[model samples]
Target: MGEEMPLSRIAAAVGTPVYVYSQAALVERAAAYVQAAQQTAARCLVCFAVKANGNPALLRLLGEQGLGADLTSGGELFLAQFAGIPPHRLLFSGVGKTSAEIQQALQAGIRALHVESWAEMERIAGIAQTLQMAAPVAVRLNPDVAADTHPAIHTGGRQHKFGVNAQAARQMLLAAADHPWLSPVGLAAHIGSQIRELAPFRQATAALLRLAADLEAVGCRLQYLDVGGGLGLDSISQAAPRPAEWVAAVGEPVAQAGYELVLEPGRSLVGDAGILLTRVEYVKEEGGKWFVVVDAGMNDFLRPALYGGEHPIWPVALRSGRQRESRADHTWRVEVVGPVCESGDTLARDYELPPVAAGDLLAVMQAGAYGYAMSSNYNGRLRPPEVLISGAAYQIIRQRQTMTHLLG
Candidate 1:
């Protein structure tokens, strides 16, 4: 807490239930990726996935570091422009892209579009062909690799909503060679997010490489192998490799294959650098269980409710620990919940919180990536502000959502 900004100051400026991201931390982290990729034989374009945390400040810092942009939406492309990332240094990826969105990417002159499905590849080709423009695209492959991640995040699985199957991709790549408007340039694979193990990445890369090899045999020129973002942060880095370590492990094949490697890193870059602060409002007991309520609800962070995700919750400011005479260790098992009226609104379940009282501060750690981006106006609670802190100084990047903003 001391190395970063003091939670006290951020709360004072933005009020509680706000998210604060450290710009310095984000910049330093981006530099690390650049350095690590340079160490390898691979010529890398480190593209920050704008789907993660698209705060203009974070994006601009990444651009200053010479990182590229990976966008999924038109707004994301616009954000990259605002962050000073030239369209040429950007790559766009998504499963469902409307015609307007594809046209926007084309006008932006993005580096490449990672086409996920056969239909998408055809759609992009048709759009580019009509405009008499040459489009460079990579075929996103569902390699059927079982990543060592939560089932819900496993995109390579047959049931997942992302990427074209290997068979379909092979057919698409060869067929794309005939399209004058679209250039078939590369292959892309993303197994899942928060993947901690090495074997799954090795498996995914090996499959993607093999698929690329087969396509090359058919006279397809493969210039880029995107290897889309899924690198994770260490909430438990004890088991998880740090950023550089993971990059080296996951990226070795790109060096061997002698292609330009594009990395779309989302959570690993921004997750640990931000925290969410909420103010405790009340405490109660029900069904022989202790409950501590806070102002930040599922509306503010849906990870817990949506994915049963693990977010380490802790006290922002330490208070003296005392023993309660009733319990053996004087600790009570507790469920930390939010103020949302829905019974499903829970931040965490069946854990321990400090003896919480009204006005106490709770900090949800490692929240920078999906926290604000996924927040909603459920229960009519205003979305929290976002802050960036440097030493003792702090600035608000996003103001708290106001009630009137919803009305409008």
Candidate 2:
């Protein structure tokens, strides 16, 4: 595979600032997920959350692995469909879903809509009724569980605007009883993202099981229980917990409670399986510190700026004579940044990178998930192209964002 078409060759052709994903790695993650949950539950469905990386190719591969989709917006729903995801395998979820979005989901007859609040449920019920269709829905419960990660991704807090509070979920379910246009398919909740510990997920699933019991006691035939995915992969490995563990922690709980399981995993699936390739533009020294400015910025990958995310940075080439075989001694720590002008626009605050001159290639590890999806045209800079690598070749999935493309 390395001899056929190494990543360095693709970066050389496309020019630096290219993102690529490995299909083999992604499939490995999917298989692990299936192996984990399939043991206890036959009615389980692993739904890949679309908001993390909306790339169609990635979705198609995940879908091919028998994974469904968890969508938050009309665009994501449309993207899911465009990627060949059947409406029956797609679940729409989000707070602040506009009536227009609800109408779209209703028309598609999606698998389920995880309604966030009582108000949204009433609206969905009305929309479904108007369309003369029964909207299969689930009430997202904010169990107030924390993922022990960054606060930005936290969604299960009572004060958070993500899901329906526990006290109100019961009442809302009762109110929803009369709305024949909607069916209580199950319950859903997302704790947060980039979580390292499994305890939070275990704890969160316990609460969801309890809520399912409460609903069942009230004569609600809850069919599904979605314990939202917040699984964290190693920052360096970009790989996460084994699928079996997640299934054991989540899928088993729903199975024990006699309900179907839906897992909406995002970053853990693609984050580590891909990386960003950029080129060094220039080098600068300030205040006795070295800086390696590259062509990539927060616009290309926002995780660093948004969550202080870290990605291993390495140079494409190393100087000769550094070593007889490997340029192991050429590596040095520097602040790898971009030309975005903001000090916060830096990509790696401090990184041990190979000695690189202008135009040398650098690979930013674990960047497949949120890398290009969160990119912007700030500083009038065009976003880079995206490539997908199989065994020994690369295909340009998305072209570099041209000035005309950005302007128009």
Candidate 3:
């Protein structure tokens, strides 16, 4: 993580079950995306998907690196603004947006609202009319492309309740073009998250470009083509396409078509940049199974329970006279469980780890993206703090939640 302060030292100071992010990693990833997009498209916007890790500090850091935000809710919209990202650099995207949220977005003057449904488009139009403002809108086209990822996260398939189908999307955009208060400005599609292959993205891009061309033939010009981001993290697979490759695959045709590119990357930018630190609470064997219980629970990191996420866990410090290579030979097959009172609270199942005592510190790798963002207070557990590491210095970006926070 490029921090001078040891992980054990930070864990000792902040207590266990804390998130630590590397500023250098965040900046490097953002730069990769931005540079790739810029090289591929003369005009582009790399909007960090705020739903991944909405820490104001992280948002501000990405914004400083010339990244905008792709927000889902009014709260995220507010967070983007609070982080000082200009409205022109912000894009609102989601399904099931409330009327109040629509009005809030319209009032905030974001670059465009990635409209998901016809009803949503109509709703935005009505609100914009009442406000006497022409709402900049983008139809979120469901290309019906099947991404090779978890079904739970797939959004672009026909069965998913995400964007409108291509035919319906075309009709909606055409209708919005003539509407009094709706300014159809872009076409967007987000197939799914954690997509490892480029074929799905290429397929989605083709579908979107064909629609854009059809619209253009009818004198309906679009400003941008938003192939919503799902570039998988390297932790998922090292063979996943790099930022440059991803941008070239999707952005080349769109750039040739003379449309600005907008990418909404979430996990790839921050996933590898942070980790969750926890302390081993107990190590026991029962019923021919070894369970290493840690202080962090599913409430602190829910990806394992929700998505069956397999994050590599490593000991922060080796015991005396233990060598890294030899320790693996002495490792035991174990299931890392948390303090939470649920069988689903297991973080890693049938994983191997070296010998660890009750007080040994463990680090959950590749947790920067969804780990803390999806956390909950479900077992009455307070959320852990988040720390940012820059060079040799570190700062607490978010304080640990207290009992009062839970009660509130």
Candidate 4:
């Protein structure tokens, strides 16, 4: 089946403003990386970024297939563990890790913690000392390689409050030997998200390799090189490199160094696997523009309003021949907006779409990664349900948020 089971059938059964995920697509996308890594000479660990889509059922499904979880907070760690990811299989990465969170991770024996600041490194060391445990740590390098993406998401630049600069990282690595509680085992850097080119990745890889070489020269033997994940998928019409291409680009250099490679992929593995199903509530024409108001607002799907993100939208029933609508050549340039009061709640502006009515269902494509994961109850609107579809069958992994739950 193609994208599978059709969004029309899903909307009919589950209602609008819902999220539908394809189980086959998710597994296939994840397995592509595993396959690519296996083909590489480098020993690799595939850690699914839990922040991307931390649905318990989804995480549990991925964990059952041997994918480890890459977490940013203690809550993500709990979700990953609840989903069956063992402590040893988790990689904790975040800028501000509380002492309590550090203690929790140390007690759980997580694989490695990507230490961002020297202060954070010290904090972890102190916590580990208190617990009488030696914590595995990796100093994240800033790299300063600017990826060609939205500036808000860029993480590796000097001004960004992400990893430490090269000099600071070098100092941290050298100082790690003095702290008996901290075992410096790796170096990590994440450039940004929604990146489409390979140059930035290659540049980041080379930078990390140089730092790794320098650290080794200074008597710091690193075990793994984590070239953090920002590998982009085709969100708009831009073509993205396949998982194999990405794996080859990043894995070859580290493979040559014989260091265990770790990739924390969030979007590329899940973005295209899901769709946001919404219903057109009204179609208005004013000021020489058509506005197609939808039931799902910024509270339900915020990517379009936040990142200026573009996702493909299609009529569900029209494509499936279930509704009496003509697939005419005529189209309307309409603004696909949500029912939120904020003017910024618009999903797409001046976009062309087939004529839609109040009852028509629209499927917002490439929504699996950040759609539901970033949803909220803003404006007191209840969050929609999530259905995982496998072939022709579908199961509601999450129920639509009820008014009772929202009120209470």
Candidate 5:
């Protein structure tokens, strides 16, 4: 935990509203997935989703731990490479990749490109032909399996603009057989994110396996099946599926189908591994309601405002020897907000906290995933720095944006 390193020390050194990640946590989280896959009947390739937190340091750490990189765009491909993730360990995914992005992936010779639609497949094939290369392809199947998570994060249902239908995927593969530049080597499916239950994953896997069986029947056997990641983490409870449990629940079926398994875990591995540290700038009362405004705004961490997600906020630098008692005594209800000039810039609403005052630091927990990755420079607020803490030592992984950065 960053607190063990005295987050205040890092804040003092690097300033407030910074992301603090534990190297121990990141390595342990990644090892959990590897250990789980080893226990499974099939070989598993764990691709760390780049869209979650593309910090080069984080990506490099995971890569050193034997995790591959799952990229969404050409920029991510470059990040993966810069992080020293081998070309063979890289997987390109997403629905809106441009023609140039596809060309870059092919030129780089990534392990595979998880094709989202038939049109994208056509584009990749055309680019591969132009480059005189055989593009490794995986058609992402939209199983129509609905996850009961937030609607915005859902990707598998037919209505979503993600993967193609099972029939369409099969047709695409058949068509790809005629294209010399395209190699249909795998099938992929991502149902949704922050999924608390396993039924949806099971249903999606069943659909993929059935399609795999049909493909085999048509002499189009898939070498791998990418069970796209959506394993959820409970921000409040600090609860999530154990790696072994997750692998058994989702990887068992794919293993039984005789296809190598690929998982693109973004949140489950890192969601609870980091926290956003912010200093309470002011505490005010207006309209008989308490507002605790912090230095960090939506520009630093946007999940709370964007997805209506809530992260447990804790006061840093607790009173010595009375932390628990102090927490128990201070039960004032307050609204956690940022200085961003927008009504929707609230972090947590109707939250109970201790007697937090100006200059007191607050750590937003379970923000390792979408927190900083989705942050923006809206309202001219500069983004925060990111610090990686290991035991009693810490280092600034990303520097806080400067005022001149906005001009650029």
Candidate 6:
């Protein structure tokens, strides 16, 4: 919606199945989060979760806006730095960290490594000892709080293989405080992603504060509380929490406790800032059902198939001769599908839209976050290009994978 060029023009210029991201949306969303944190907390770091979308151009743009990075792997760390995000602004976090990745983060002198287990802490300690460097650490505590989101993305509960329990976290932090190579700099917890309500965050923050109090009693003071992010995007029926509301939910208590706040917002920041431009390849009818098939597949955009994600699709331009159709038309009931081999590649089932035919252009909304980040070379399909739009101008940040490149 923020783009100056028409969707048809973009489709024609870049070909179908290209990702188009709005620079204005990215800036606006980032500013909102930073402003909220500044207003609520005395000290805060609003880190963009790099796992959501790691395009170099997008990362560079975000870095220029004064946002830090929440990295989950060595590649992400490298990309963040490559984008001009300084080491002090990068925080590495993940459940499983290779010895090499730990060493890499330590050598890079990142802000902190959010440790998820005692074994990981020991590993970090070993790596730091070898490097003769003090590794900044944050224990990711599993608050056992349930979030109302897709189970595939859930991470905070005890059943999930995410963070350690509060007891284990306390023990790890205390041990880190005593260790020579590890510096216990922060306490952290991430319940899950795409969380829509504030109640679960409130519960998790309360638990973090209680744990911080116990640690402080023993002279173990933390510099910040890393509340991992999962703020959800707006749904058809329910509205997600705004960045300010989410910041307040977790920031207020941490600020009152005299600790800095760290948030790893992933989907919420970039989710609504992008769209997937695709072209309709065919319209077929089978078993008394209509199907609108597009060129994009699960290998290109996996959210709909992997997580049952329901991204709204709209025609880029209505037929020149046809009038605007009403929703009551039964002929519009159709299943929007992709060319992937699996049946799960269906993007939307029983979706209502105006009559669409082959050669029509469609835009899939709200795909900025996990769309391209999770794509693969499955079935040997080439990944699509990525375009960044800023007002009237647009640039192709990532070129489409060529067959020569893929084979080479």
lDDT value for model 5: 0.87
Query: Could you tell me every candidate's TM-score relative to the true structure?
Result: 0.94, 0.94, 0.97, 0.95, 0.96, 0.97
Model 6's C-alpha root-mean-square deviation from the true structure amounts to 1.8
Clashing pairs in 5: none
Q: How would you encode candidate 5's per-residue C-alpha lDDT over 1-408 as one tens digit per residue?
A: 643698888888999889999999999999988878767855779999999999999999999999998899899999999999999889998889999998888888899999987788888888888888999999999999878777889988889898898899999988777678888889989898888788898898889899999989989988888888998887564466665677788799899878898889999999889999999898888998889999989888888787788789988875444343323665788899999998778989989997777888999998899878988899988888888988888888999899999997
lDDT tens digits, residues 1-408, model 2? Answer: 112457678977898788878878888887777666678687888889888788898889888888889998999999999999888889988888999999999898789888888789889988888999988888888888766677888777776888877778777776666677877787888888888778878888888888878877888778788898888767653555665677787777689778888888888887877889888888777897778888888888888888888787766565454332323465666888888878888787767776776767888887877788888888888888888888887788889988797666
Off by over 4 Å in 5: 237-239, 318-329
Summing lDDT over every window of 10 consecutive residues in candidate 2, give the lowest-scoring window: 319-328
Candidate 4 lDDT, 65-96, residue by residue in tens: 67888899999998998898888779999999
- Lowest lDDT 10-mer window, candidate 4? 318-327
lDDT of each: 0.82, 0.81, 0.91, 0.87, 0.87, 0.90
User: Residue 34 lDDT in model 2?
Assistant: 66
Instruction: Please state the error at residue 10 of candidate 2 in Å.
Output: 0.5
* Residue 36 in model 6: lDDT: 96
Q: State, as a TM-score between 0 and 1, how close model 5 is to the true structure.
A: 0.96
lDDT of 1 at 26: 80
Segments of candidate 2 deviating more than 4 angstroms = 1-4, 236-240, 319-330
Better of 2 and 5 by TM-score: 5
Q: Which candidate leads the pack in lDDT?
A: 3
